[model samples]
Target: MATVIHPTAIVEPGAQLGADCEIMAYAVVTKHCVLGDRVAVHPFAVIGGDPQYLKFDRASATGVTVGAGTVLREHVTINRSIYPGKATAIGENCFFMSGSHAAHDCEVGNHVVLANAALLAGHVGVGDHTFFGGGAAVHQFCRIGESVMVAGHASITRDVPHFTMVAERDDVIGFNAVGLRRRGFARAAIAELKTAFHEVYFTPGNIRDVAAARRAAGAFDSAEAKRFLDFFAGGKRGFARARRAEAEAGE
Candidate 1:
């Protein structure tokens, strides 16, 4: 399996290419950039450009690396690390759709999908199997946990927890039920998670205090419950409160 580089592509010296990798027309793979086996760079995709960090000096510019089987769509821009001589990485099997941008030092995990126009700010960390819908934007330094689904056009400024479905302005309405089911969570486990959600967000008590108490009491007794609690607890910008109708109905 020979690597394929389009005639118009510019792959700089010292940029390593793996077997079966494809660099399309007009794409640029800059110095020290490494593309793993079967990686696909679509036309106009830009990889390994210098960091956009204001504090970074040209002499200390770092590089970018893409892992095996990843696909970078047309016009996608992935920048290098801000720290001198370091590398920013995109994990294996991930998909970056057209026009998406990953800023300097961002860490994207394996199997994650970034939809068209989704943007990840510098130093953001996106966990494996997460999906960022079209036009979603993550703030700098935020952490998005594994298997989460961020709804289209949502603006995320805070950390999003694993296995959650967040939508409509910081509202974590529920667990990622479809994702959980696909990942083999049993019916009992799902039911327990639902109960935890009710208690944490829908009940009459103060959300933070109630969540803390539930955590202390070990209520629900599952890894999902703990993860949910931990996410809410660690929130610097607090989670959204349940809707008025939902809160009233839960009473």
Candidate 2:
């Protein structure tokens, strides 16, 4: 299938458009951008724009790579990376709703959904199959885990664990129970995650310490639980916490 670019769309020289890509009216695909097969860039959407950072050099060799079948809605903007030899990448089959933005150097995994006006700050890492509600805002460099659901307008400042639901105050409110069910996760798997959440996140102590104790006690019984444990162990932004009596007591 031939790629279609509307007459009003500006696909600059050196931009790579894969087979069957549809670049709509007034959309801009910058010179360094690469769009994979069947990508639909809606009207007024902009891809591979210059980084917003002050220190970024315009002459630096960097761009955006949008994976196959991704849809960029109207007015959505995905910026290129800030450094040379880098690219801000969006994974395959993701749906970016209108007015959403993914900032420079961010890496978003496949099948993620960013609702209208959801925003990800620079260098944020998002895992697969996560859903960000409308107007939810992630702080710069935060890591969001897979299968997570961020509630609308929530403020996320720290790393969110897999299959978790983040709501008010950026707290890890609970497991993404409805999402898990909708995704056909086994009943046992969902139960295991709930137990892990209580032990690792809701325990009235230092979350890491509680996670360690659960590991020592073999409290994590399933492979899903093990992955949950590993996420916290390797997390960079640290885990999001709710108001806990133990933490307040120590303070």
lDDT tens digits by residue: candidate 1, 175-220: 6778878878888877777778677766677777888889899887
> Among these predicted structures, which one has the highest lDDT?
2
Q: lDDT per model, in order?
A: 0.83, 0.88
lDDT of 1 at 21: 95
lDDT of 2: 0.88
Segments in model 2 whose C-alpha atoms lie over 4 Å from true places: 216-218, 243-251
Pairs of residues clashing in candidate 2: none
TM-score of each: 0.86, 0.92
Residue range 161-245, candidate 2, lDDT tens digits: 8888887667777677788888888889888887787667666877777777787788767887777777776656777875544
Model 1 quality (TM-score): 0.86
Model 2 C-alpha RMSD vs. true structure (Å) is 3.8
Candidate 2, residue 49: the lDDT equals 96
